[model samples]
Target: MIKPSSYCNEDDGEFKKEWKNDSNSSSVNSSTLSLHIAAYENSSNSDMASTADTEGLKGKHSLAKKWKNAKHPFFGSSSVIQNSFEFTRQQENDKVSQSEIMQFKASQKLLNPNSSVNHQPGEKNMCLFTLLRCSDLVMQKQRNPEKKKHLLVKKLAKEGYNDIYSNEPTKFIYLGNAGFVCGVSPTYLQELFGKLDGFHKLHSFRHKSYAFVEFKTVEDGKRAYELYDFPAIEAAPKAILPKGLSVISEFITPEYEEELLGFLNENNEDMKNRSVLHFGHKFDYDSNSAFQKGLDIPPILDELIKSMQPHFGTHFPDQITVNRYRPGQSIPMHVDTHSAFEEPIISLSLQSSINLDYTHCANPTVNTEISLPRRSLLIMKGESRYCWRHGIRPRASDVGEDGELVPREERYSITFRKIRTKPCECPYIEYCDWNRNGVTAIPSNNESARQVEKTYVQQVYEDIAEHFSQTRHSKWNAVANFLDSLSKGSVVLDAGCGNGKYLSTKTDKFFMGFDTCHNLLRVANTKGEVMNGSLFEIPIRDSVCDAVICIAVIHHFSTVERRKAAIAEITRVLTSGGKALITVWSIDQKTDGQMSAYAKMRSNKEPTEMKQENNAKLMIHDGTDFSHCDMLVPWQRSSDGAQFFRYYHLFYKDELDALVESFDELTVIDSAYEQGNFIVIFQKK
Candidate 1:
C-alpha cells in the first residue's frame, strides 16, 4: 500500500505570515516548538539544494512554499507542517519514541482518504506521516528521476488514480506491486502474462514497484486485467525445465566450433546442398529411424565423441547425424523411435541460438520453449526422451526473455545415439512405437524441395505483400532506361511484376503484368492491367509480346531445372528479335572494396565469414559475403516484428550469361553487375 501526499502551492511571504499567525495560537510548548522550527530551517537549505539539482531553483522555491502552506485536519492549519518537520528531525537523531510513531501512523490514516481504518472524530494527531514520506521521496528524486516517476506512478495507481492513456487503441495495462522492487522479475512476469491471449511484451521498472503489460489489443489488456491474479504471481517458481533434460551452455570453445565446422565442410561436400548428413548409419525419415549402418565417422568426430564419454559413463554413442538449418527452417515435433535407439540422446549446437519447444504427448496445451545457445550441449533421457515431443518452430527470429526480437542466424547441430538391439522398456508406454507398432514413410526428394519453395518463397511474398510493396516503390534506373528504349505502342510483358512497379515506366507502351501472389496482384491491379499467374506457366500466347522483362524473379526456383523452365517461358512469350532484361541477386555484393546498397542497409557491425561447402543451400545474413550459391534471406516486417525468409539462388560472375547461352535461340546483348544483382539483357533470335 502507498500513501501519496497532496500539497497546495502558495506565495512564500503569504505562507510564512499564515504559519506565524497559526504558530502563535498553537498550544505546543514554547521550547519544543522553537527546537522543531530551528531544526526545520537548518535542514531546509540542504533539502532545497537537492531539489534544485533535478527541478531547478524555481521548482525548489515552489516546493518550499507548498511545504510551508500545507494544512492539517486535526491540528488546524499549518500544524501538520510543523509536526512533519519535527518527525524529520527525530528520524535523523534516531530518538523517536514508540508513542510518537503510533501517532504518526494515525496521522497517515487520517490523511489518506482511501484508508479503510476508522478513526474517532476530532482525535488529536501529532504528526503528518505522508508529508514526511513525501519529503524523503523528494530526496530520492534528486538521485534517480526515473525511479521517482515510477514510485509516483505506483503510488497514484494504488490510490485508484486513472493511469492508462493512449491516443490509439489501448494495449497496455498497469500492474501495481509487480516489478523488480517488489521481487517480481521481467522473466517471471513474461511467464505469467505470456499465457494470456494476445500478450505481446512486459515492461518492468526495476526501482519502481510496478509494471506495464502490453497486449496485442485493448480487449486483450482488459481481459488480462480481469483474469490475472497478482497476489499469486510472487509465489510461482522461476523456471521448470523437463525432467531428465539438461542444457550446458558454452560446452565447446570457439576454436573447437571452427574445427568441427571445417571438418564437416571438407568431408560432407557431396551432400552440402542437403540439410542433413549422416555417419555410422543413414537416418530414414519415412520410418522415423536409422538404418544402413557401416558408414565411417570421420576421425575428428570420433575423437570428439570419445571426449564426451566421461559424461555418459559406460554407454558410448556410435551413430551421428548432422543437421543444418536456415533461419526459417524447422523440424517437426517428434520423439525418436523407441526400438531404433537407446536412452540418453545427446546433441551439440553451433553457430547460432534457437528455441526448442517441448510438449507433453498426452496434452497438446502443455508446452514450453527453451533456448539452446551456440556451442551448447543438450542431453535427454527418461521422461524427457520418451514422453515429451520436441521440435523447433519455423521462424527467422524468436521473442527474447525481455520481450524483444532476437534475429536468427545459420545453425548446425550434431546429434549422437547408439543403436538399440532389444525393444525399449521405458515406463512411458503411450508414446512407444514398439508397443503401438507404428511406421511412417519419408517424403520424396522432389516434394521436399517443392515444400521449401512453398514455405520460404511463395508464402513469404504473400504474407508480406503490403510491406514489400511499400519498400519496392522506387524503380531501378537501368530498368527504367530499358523501358524508355522500347518503341511506342510496343506490347510489353512484365513477368513476376510485383505491385506492377514497372508497368507504368513507359506510358507510351502497352504494358501487362502477372504475378503468382494474389495479394501482390491486387496491389498491382490498381496500377495497370495485371493478372495472377506463375512464371513457369505464363498465361500468354507464343510471340504475343514485343518485349518481356523477368526482373528479380528466376532466383526463387529451388532447382536449376525449374529456373531453366522459367527462362523458357519468358522466351516463349517474346516475338522474334524481342529484348528481355533479367536480374537475379548476385553472390558478390561488394565491388572495389565498397559494399552495395543492400549490404549498407544492414548493421555496421563487422560481418562474419561463412565457411564454404559444395553448393550448400545455407542461410545468409544481410551484409555478410555469400558462402553458398543457394540461400535463405530474412525480411522483417516493422509493424509487428514478424520475420519472413525469402529463398534466393544467387548467381556468380558469368553464371547468368552461361545460363542464357545454353539456349541457342537467345543471344546475350549486354551483362553487368549492378546494385547487388546480376543484370543480363538478351534478345530472341
Candidate 2:
C-alpha cells in the first residue's frame, strides 16, 4: 500500500493499513511536496487563524515559523527521533512494495554512505522541512550515467540516457533525515553530506518514491541548508537542475552536434578541458559600448550604470563594470576580490538576467545561486558579498521554449563597486589608512573581533517620488492616514521630519515640517516651510496648528529625559486641548514581556558586542547629543519595531491611564496591539 513518497523502507513497514496505496496517499504525496502546508497542518501550537486584532500581527510569514519549530527541537529530542523511524517502518509495511527497497538503498549509499538508526521520538521528517534559508527539501535529482541511481523515476519514462556525460552522471543523495542531498560524483559527497553532524541517512527508500532524510541535530540541518540550497547548485553553472524529477526523455530534445560545433567554433577560447560553460563575466568594467563577444546587450542597461552612483556613494571612483552573456557561456567558480568592493558590490540585472553563484570564502563549502531577474537591483554586502564572493555560471538553456531554466541561456549583470573609500585593509591591501584600505578592516572570526558601535543607525531608505522614505512602506502609510483625518489648509508641522516623507503624502498644500537634520529638510521644500529645528524649541507661533502627528520618530531617544523634552514640545505646540495623533512603541512590551527573553539569551553567554559597515551615518552628530547605537544591543532582544527604542514601550492599561491623568487634557480613546506594533488613537478634550 505504501505509495513511496514517505521514503520509509520496506522492512520497517512505515505506511499505515487502509491508508497504504490509498487514493489519499497521492494527496499526502502532494501535501508533502509542499512543506509549508505540511508544517501548518502537522505542527502543534501554530496560529492558523488570526482572531486577535494585534496591530502589527496582520500578515506574518507562516513558513518561517514552521521551519523554526520543526527544525529546532527534533535534533535534541530522542523521543522524536525514535518516533520518526517507527513511523517510517510502519508506513513501509502498509504500502511500499518490496521490489523498490533494494534500488532505493543502493541509491542512498552512493549519494551518502553514512547511515545510522534512531530510538528517538518526534524526529524531523524533511529538510525544506526545517532549514530556514531553504524553502523545501523535495528537490528531484538527475540520474548518473551508469544508471546507478535508485531514483524514484516513473517506470515507463526513459528518454535521454545517450546525452548524459559518461564520466560524471547525476545521482541523488540523502541530506540529513528529512531532506534529499544530490551529488555529481563521489567527491561531492563531502560537500553535500559532510556538514550534517547529527544527521543519519535513511538508506531504505521504502517506496523509492521519496527518500526520508533525518537530522540528529537542528544545527546539522541548518548546516545542510548552508551547504545544499537549490540556488547553491548555481555555483556550478554548467550543472542545471531541471524542473522537478520528470522524465528528461519527455522534456529533452536531441541536440544537433553540428549546431553545437558551430557555436563552439565561434568561441575564441578552446573548450577541450572545460566541464561547463559560463554565460556571465565582466570582460571590462570600463567597456562603455559592447565587447568583442558582440553581445546585443539591452538598451535599458543604461539605468544599471546610473544607479551605482547613488548607492556606491562618493567612494565609487570609477564608472561601474558591465558584463553580458548569451546562451552556453558561463564563468566558473571564482572570486571578484578587488579593492573596488570597499563598501559593497551593488549590481543591477537587466535584459538578459542570470544566476549568481554566491559562496563564502570562510565556508567555501557553503554556496547558493539565487536567480537575478531583469530590472532587479541586488544589494549584496557582508556575508554574501565582502566576506565571500559572487559569480555567474553559464548553461545551454536560458529559458526553455516553455520558459524555464533552459539548461543554458544568455544573461548580463552590472556591478557597481566603491573602489575608493576610507583606506581599509583586505588581504590584497598595501600600507594605508581607513581611506586607503578596503575589505581588510572587516573583522574575521579568526581576528580579535572589535566592537563596531554605530555612531548613528543607518536606516535603509527608499525614494517613492523625489522624497526619501523607508523601503518598509509603513511610514508612508502612517503619514497618509494622519493626513486624511485632517482639515484642509491645516498648518501641520512634521517634527523630526525625515526627508519630508509626510509632505509627499497627498495632503492639502498647507503641510510644513521641521527636523533635527538640516540636510534632510533641504530637499523637503513643502508648501509652508521645513526649517532646521529641534523638538525642544519650536520656531512656530504657539497654538497655530489644530493637530500634531508624529510617527516612528520618538523611538530614537534612548533615555527618558530626551523623551520627556520631546513630549513637552508637542504639548507646547498644541492649542488648548488640540488633538495629537502619535505612535510610540508600547513600553509595557519591553519591561515584563521582553526582559525575560533578553535575560535568557544573555544567560546563555550570548556575545556582548557586534560590528557594522559605516556607509553614511543616518543621524548626524550635533557634537553634544548621545551617540546612536545599532537597533539591537548584543544579548538584548528586541523585535524589529522595538529595536530602535530603549525598550518596547508597550503601555499597560494603567500606564495609559496614568499618562492621561498627568496630562489632564489628553485622553486615550482607543488602542490596539498586533505583532510588535501598538496603535493608540488619542483625543484632546
TM-scores, all candidates, are 0.40, 0.35
RMSD, one per candidate, in order: 21.6, 20.3
Compared with the true structure, all predictions reach lDDT values of 0.61, 0.36
| TM-score of model 2 (CA atoms) | 0.35
- Model 2 root-mean-square deviation: 20.3
- The parts of candidate 2 lying over 4 Å away from their true place are 1-94, 97-100, 103-479, 526-528, 585-661
Quick one: best lDDT, which candidate?
1
Clash count, predicted structure 2: 88
Alpha carbon deviation, residue 230, candidate 1 (Å): 36
Tens digit of per-residue lDDT, candidate 1, span 1-685: 0111111121122222332343354553231222111001111244442332222111112333222211111111110121121111111112334365445434432222233333232211112111122233355545422223333333333322212221222345544445455554465455455546566655554344445555655567657644531121112132357889998889888998999988776655334333777888887877767877846887877677877787676887877899888787787777787779988889999898888988654333446778888999999988888867788877778654432347988899999988887887776543455633321111124565577678778899999999999988888877878888889999999999999998877778999999999999999998899988889899999998889888899888777777788889989999999999999988887665445677555422222221223233334333346656776676778678565667778888888888888998999998977888888999999
Residue 75 error, candidate 2, Å: 22
lDDT for each residue of candidate 2 in 1-685, tens digit (9 for 90 to 100): 1123333344323322222333134333322211110011111112311111111111222211112111111121101000011111122223333455445444443322123434233321221222211211211122121111112111101111001111110112222323221111222222234224444433333223223333433345445534432221111232232111111121111232233334433543323323222222223424222122423333333443454456555553233444445566666444344343365556655444566665433233334546555555676544344344455544454432222333544444445554433334553221112333222232222221112111122221111212233232345344466568777777676776666666656546466777665445655664346787767687788777667776655554433455456666777787765656566544332232222222222221111111123432222111111123312221112223111212112333444334434666667765544323345556566
